[model samples]
Target chain A: MDVILNFIAENLPMITILTLATFVGIEIIAKVPTVLHTPLMSGSNAISGVVVIGAILLIRDAKPDEYLTLIIGFLGIALAMINVVGGFAVTNRMLEMFKKKKK
Target chain B: MERHITDFLYLISIVVFIFGMKGLSSPATARKGNLTAAAGMGLAILIALFSPAEGSFDNHIWIIAGMVVGSAIGLVSAKRVAMTKMPEMVSLFNGLGGATAMLIGFIELKNYQPAVISTVKSLLSNGEAANLMNGEVFSSIFALIIGAVSFSGSLIAWGKLNGSLRDNIKLPAPQIVNLVTLTAIIALSVMIMNGEEMNFALLLILTVLGLFYGVAFVSPIGGGDMPVVISLLNSFTGVGAAVAGLIYGNNIMIIGGILVGASGTILTVLMCEAMNRSLISVIIGGLGSSGSSSGSDREEVVKEATPADLAIQLKYSERVVIVPGYGLAVAQAQHVCHELEQSLEAEGVDVKYAIHPVAGRMPGHMNVLLAESDVDYDKLMELEPANDAFNNTDVVLVIGANDVVNPAAKTDTGSPIYGMPILDVEQAKNVIVFKRSMSTGYAGIQNPLFFGERTKMLFGDAKASLGKLKEELNNA
Candidate 1:
């Protein structure tokens, strides 16, 4: 109990940001029409690729002799980059088709 | 100073993501919205590379090489994938995201020894090693479990979507097994967190259990419920990423992950509602397993129609509504369907598409397929509007669609898909369904809509049938 309280007190600001962001997320997403659901899903799936940042940090902070951690971190970076790049590219492709119908 | 700059940029990225999502609320701005979000992601990645860190941060070559290889693979696959196979592609990419999160958690645990030792040393004087737990460590375990589950679950979903995995993989008492695995994982996680030493072996066991639970969780679900599963897994990946963010106190990751998580949850609920099932029932699986036995006993006479007949009826009709499903994509007939629509339109007939929310393998799957064939976006009508329009519609062409238009959903309470919303094609003056045979739909339930007096079945491949119709219409 004391440990949880200490952790909460130390990270209050980040927690607040997360709470507010959740509300904002629901509000924005609830308005997306059914026609765009696929793109909405794929686009947000891309956003979740923000873990690429964590992968970068993992590699940046690894010790010199920690080859195992380094390999794991490298794979993390590569896989995360795949998610980010592939997600966005595929979303763009789908959206482009939607865009062409406008003309 | 560097920290403040990084934080500020991340905040900016968050704002951009919000705007991007807001732009996706309608079709007019959806493409731009996606592009804006991609730009935000790029900005976040660039900022992360230059952000302050404790270690050497000198692994530039490794990072660049990884990015190059990953981007090449991503770009090529994105270009090569057919529009019909989009659901599989999305599932694969989502699995990659989940895998990345799991790896991050693994690496964080590997480097957690120093923190554990220091905390233990500080607590030795107090003789309370149990109180040595902190949020960073807790968040890492959370990420590990959720990420591992999402990763394996999504791969199974992808395999199912692409036909590489069979739909009916029987497990002996699956629910019980899943429950036990979940309980064990939770118990192991708590033990690792509260234990005196960092137990890497126990952590490995927990991860393996999580992965097994994911496979067990998704294996029993029928294919018709895949959209909900995919959406739920997408949210799992998002929540995992958010927890990873919590571990590092990264604002962009927190906000971005939360947004995806929220959106994916909404989509999951929407899909379940479309099918008239509760979230729990969908997760329990087996809705469509016994469908063939219950609905296959009917021996009603089916009326057949030729492509030439359909073409003429369609030509003389005033308003035509086309309902497309997964079969259309399987036959690769979207372009031919579009050609038929254009030919009918040239005859002064009004052509509109009625798109059920769960028409294909994923949400809005049919809309994307038709859009790829250059169909006008204005012509696609959603469920409610399409239902209303059916009252005035002169003809409905159900091309390779089944359950979405099944009248049994309205009349047969004993039907597996009872209470689910349907296209109400029976309300129209004439109905024509294009299929290869009288076989059941993805749900394996008989559609009485096929036997209705107003309905006519045109038996052939959707592409060849539609092509013949187009030729007939042109020659007429």
Candidate 2:
């Protein structure tokens, strides 16, 4: 229990940020109308691809001899890139249709 | 100093993301919102590449290769995928994101070798290092479990959406099996957390169990419930990414992931509410699995109509509303439907579309299809307004829709879909439904609307019927 408290004390700032961000997320998303749910979903799906930073850091910090770790990191970067690119492109495509219709 | 700059940029990305999301609240700013979010992502990626590294950047080639290959595939698929297959494509991308998070977590845990040794040493002393190590390990395990589940569950959902997998796969005592698996996973995770050394085999086993739980969780869910499943899995991927952020101490990832997680959760709830089902019932599956039972015993009196009759009725009507469903997509008839609407409008009839929230495979699916065919956005009416207009509507042409317009939802208390909100099509003066046969809808229940006092069934494929209706309208 002491150990857990010490860890929380050290990372209190990050935890607080995350906790507050959750409410902001809910507030912003609740206002979106149903007509844009698909685009909203895909757009946020793209945002979650920010994990690519983690993958890049992993690859950056790996030793040359760590072939297995490097391979895994490579796969991580590739998959995350796919998610980010595909999600945004598909969302744009859907929204473009909506745009043309409005005109 | 360099680390501070990168962190500042990440904060900027978070703010941009918020504004982008806010812009999606209406149709007018939606396209710009998507573009702004993409720019933010691009800025973040560029900043990440040049950010401070603990070690010299040795894997630049691999990173660039991965980005190029992934971009090519993403662009090609996004450009070529038919709008009707949007649900499956989104599911596939979400699964990829989950798989990426799982892989990152696995590497993070495996690379914590130095921390393990120090943790053991600190355990014999004051245990300062042990606390930090434990926190990192906890985040890694959380990300791994959630990511693995999202990955496999979303793949199953994608398969079901694309019709590559069967609608529902019945497992023997699935609930019990899932409960056991979940308990085992929790037990294993706790053991790993409390252990002094890294248990690689146990971690592997935990990942496998998570993947197994995902398949079991989604196997029994009917296809009609896929939107809820997909939304839930999307949130799982988001939460997994947020946990990965925790492990890496990346604020951008934490905020971005939390936003997606919250968005997905809201969408899941909205989908369930549209069908008047709770999230628990959706997860338990089997809502529409049974054959038609309640209204099957009664004599079904269905009225039949021809394309000419519908054409004549639509021509004389002052107002017409079309309710479209998944069948419209399957028949690839949105363009023809649009053409028919135009011909009716040429005769001075007011034409509009009534879109149920859960009309197609996903939310806003019918709107996307109608928009793709160049339908005016102003003519699309949501449920409440459409219901109000139905009272004054001269004719309601239900194209390939069944459950949404089913009067049983409002009147038949014993019906499977009772208490669900449905379009008030029965209140309109005339109703014409385009269907293939007397077969039940996705819910596997009989729609009493087919036998209503004013209902008429034009039995044929939706595309053929719409084409014939267009020809007849032009001839008249």
Candidate 3:
């Protein structure tokens, strides 16, 4: 019981915050109009980029003793960077589809 | 103490993200999605500051500068970007998720090595092996390889969707190579688990192999299968987040990731169903191949009709219904379509738009494009509602839409898009199709709407054709 309590105490803050955020997000999702869904989904994906940011920070902050953590952080940052750049690139490409011929 | 603040902000950001997504689900509330997402992101950054991780204002100054510059470019481009390119925009969005996953994973891996070794040394001196294992080593290394694959795979999907990657060209023998590389990656993953005596060389080889597999895996898929690919990539992003959450012991990441993965999977299946294709076929498929190539390239099939001829029919008709498709978007003819509707309404003819669910690349795409042209929201009826209006209408004017109005859906079983629900434009008394030429839809199948007895083909640019008809309508 003491061990479980200690475990919960250490990680409780991040957990509670994330849970609340998720609840709120779900609430908003429930009300979303049909026509706006695709764009909304796309935008959400863009915002979820916090994961990349987190990974990069983790890498930069890695203690010399934590080699595995360092490697994982680097991997996360790299992938997230790709997502950010490629996402923007793909979005630009998509927007081009809408360019009208100027008469 | 600082952790509380981080927790509050992270939770707030996640909620905001959800709300933004919800608002985007419907066209009626789409405008709000952008704001909601932005707020969520703002909250997320704020939360990140209070995290257990150390942060100095100086280090973040560069990030702030980058945001400002990025925002300027994003704002300008978003404003200037045409609605027709929305699918590509969606593809790009999916790419971001994949890329982010890969980056985070990589960062995690790179950071773990030294942390593990030091912890191990400390444990050895103190004779505590378990203490070193629980800290960061395993999680970080695992994240790196997974993240790399996600990043490369997403870019390939984006390329395929944007036409930078062609599905028409099947890379033969690549499938076998992909299989072999995948097997090797699995083996490497096992090798990675063999203590923290870091093998950088093996990891590098594995990354290259995974990269090659990612490209080959996504290359053979045609442009038509992009939506499903995007959905799959979305799931991958979710999984990445979940993994990241696990590494950091963040519960929100786990929950959010699971939800995203589940929803994205469902969405992928729905999109596949919409295209009348299976997930397996899409993943390992090539369109514009085995299907109907008989009439697709036939030049003599193009039928030209003047606006005067269409005007004659419209002048006599009591009711007219306009069905818009991707072609209208391509021509930027929504304004013209609205103009045509207004003129028809002025002449005592009832004008309504029959909107298909998946018409014009995305759901409610036609609605947004038409709305931009000042078309009335009430006049635009959904597939079921508009189908009712079609029965009573005298003339069905299908502008720049093919398969949606095709009679072949009713008769052709051999066609890939046979069972898909389509607007029964052919059933109308008089049907006129304004088009550039006889072209297949996204499914790459010829529409039999052209061959319909009542259907008359008016071949030309959709916008120009609509403008000409508008001119004739005014004269009439």
Candidate 4:
């Protein structure tokens, strides 16, 4: 308990930014008319796929005793990779149609 | 040595990402925006993989293997995915994201030094040692629980949407169970907060239970309610990512996670408005099976119109409104619908599409369908504007859309969708409904709107009907 509070007290600024970002994100998302809501969902979903970076970073720092971390990191890498590659690919497929409208 | 340069690169990537999102909002620049976002992602990943801080990855082959296997699966499935199955694809892909986040937290729990005095003799008094374990513990465990829920819950939703789950699995008093499970998780969090030694063993067990908790949470939700469920689970993955971001203190991950979480939540709110239901009611979920609404059982006379007759209706109409529903998605008639719209427009008849907020599977389901068929974004109208346009619309050609255009949603107090907002196609001068059968919508309630004097029903396959109309109109 004390450790958490102390950490929060130290990183208060970063925590505040995260909190603020969440609210600001909601405001921006709410402004998106429902017409584009599906793309919005998929686009943001692609963003969540960014966790692959965290997995890669973890693998780079793996210690000898961190065998479980290694296995989990392997799985994370694979899964997150799917999200990143598939999400971007699908969203791009949908978005390209919109560009055709311009022509 | 690489940390400073990598951080600078990360900064550049984040700036580009922000610009990409801004450009994504409009149709004209959306493709460019998607490419720009991909470039930023490329920059971020290149730094992480090739120029990461600290020690380099030891197992190059395993990393490459994971990448290859995952890419093959994602690419093949995405390529083979039909437009009709896009909802399931989105749900399943989002689940993978959640599962990955959960695994990161899982393996992270192993990084904690074993809880023994002999093993940690040097850290027996070291505040730094305790702080390291305590600091990451909360976020780590938190991500495990939520991500597990998202993974399992989304898989179940995908099954249901694809017709693999035929029945809405009923759980008696699910709210009670959901409440109990939630409270237990909170108590568990409090334990972590108060420094209960942070056991990985207990968290692993809790994660298993959390997986079940997701199934428990979603199974009771009725069939018609899957859109909200899918959206909510999509947000759950984002929240999981957000927690993962905190563990690594990565700015782009943090920003990305928050962006997804907030956007999904807003989309859920919009869905609630479109359904004319409260968020609480939707979450409670099992009410869809109540089967309690009492009304007319006798079949009413429906005015049937043939394709040639419908073509004639379109030829003379001054303003035409096209309401695309889920059936349109199933029939894959969006291309044909757009073809018909153009034929009408060239003849100087103004044509627009009416899109209910919850019309198809997702908020933008109808739009994507129409856009894929190259329908201009300017022609798509929302609920309010659609209803407004209907007032002056000479004919509303409802293609496989039933519940959204049903008048009972407004006038019939006993209707299941009463108090729900609906497209007032009932107000249009002439309403032509195209559907497969006289059956009710997913709501299962017989729509009196079908029996209304001004409404005419065209029964057949939506795509074929549109094909015939397109052919006839083109020849004219």
True contacts kept of each: 0.77, 0.70, 0.24, 0.64
Clashing pairs in 4: none
Angstrom error of the Cα, residue B67, model 2: value is 1.0
User: lDDT scores for all predictions?
Assistant: 0.84, 0.83, 0.60, 0.76
lDDT of 4 by residue, B259-336 (tens): 778778877877877787877888875434665445567756989987787787788889999999999999999888
**Tens-digit lDDT track of model 3 for B68-175:** 444454455455556676666655545555555555545444334433344211211112333323324344444455545555676776665455665454677655
In candidate 2, list every pair of residues with a backbone clash. Answer: none
Task: Give the residue spans of candidate 4 off by over 4 A.
Answer: A1-4, A63-68, B1-4, B55-57, B114-133, B166-168, B188-201, B345-349, B469-476
Chain B in candidate 2 has what TM-score?
0.93
Error of 1 at B386 (Å): 1.5
The most accurate candidate by DockQ is 1
Full ranking by DockQ: 1, 2, 4, 3
DockQ of each: 0.67, 0.65, 0.20, 0.59
Model 2 C-alpha lDDT per residue in residues A26-74, reported as the tens digit of each score: 8887866888888888788877787887777677777777888788888
What's the true lDDT of residue B318 in model 1?
Answer: 96
Q: Which ten residues in a row have the lowest lDDT in candidate 3 chain A?
A: A94-103
Instruction: Show model 1 residue runs off by greater than 4 Å.
Output: B114-132, B290-295
Off by more than 4 A, model 3? A1-34, A59-103, B23-30, B50-58, B114-150, B164-169, B173-181, B251-259, B276-278, B291-303
Is model 2 an incorrect, acceptable, medium or high docking prediction?
Answer: medium
What level of docking quality does candidate 3 show? incorrect
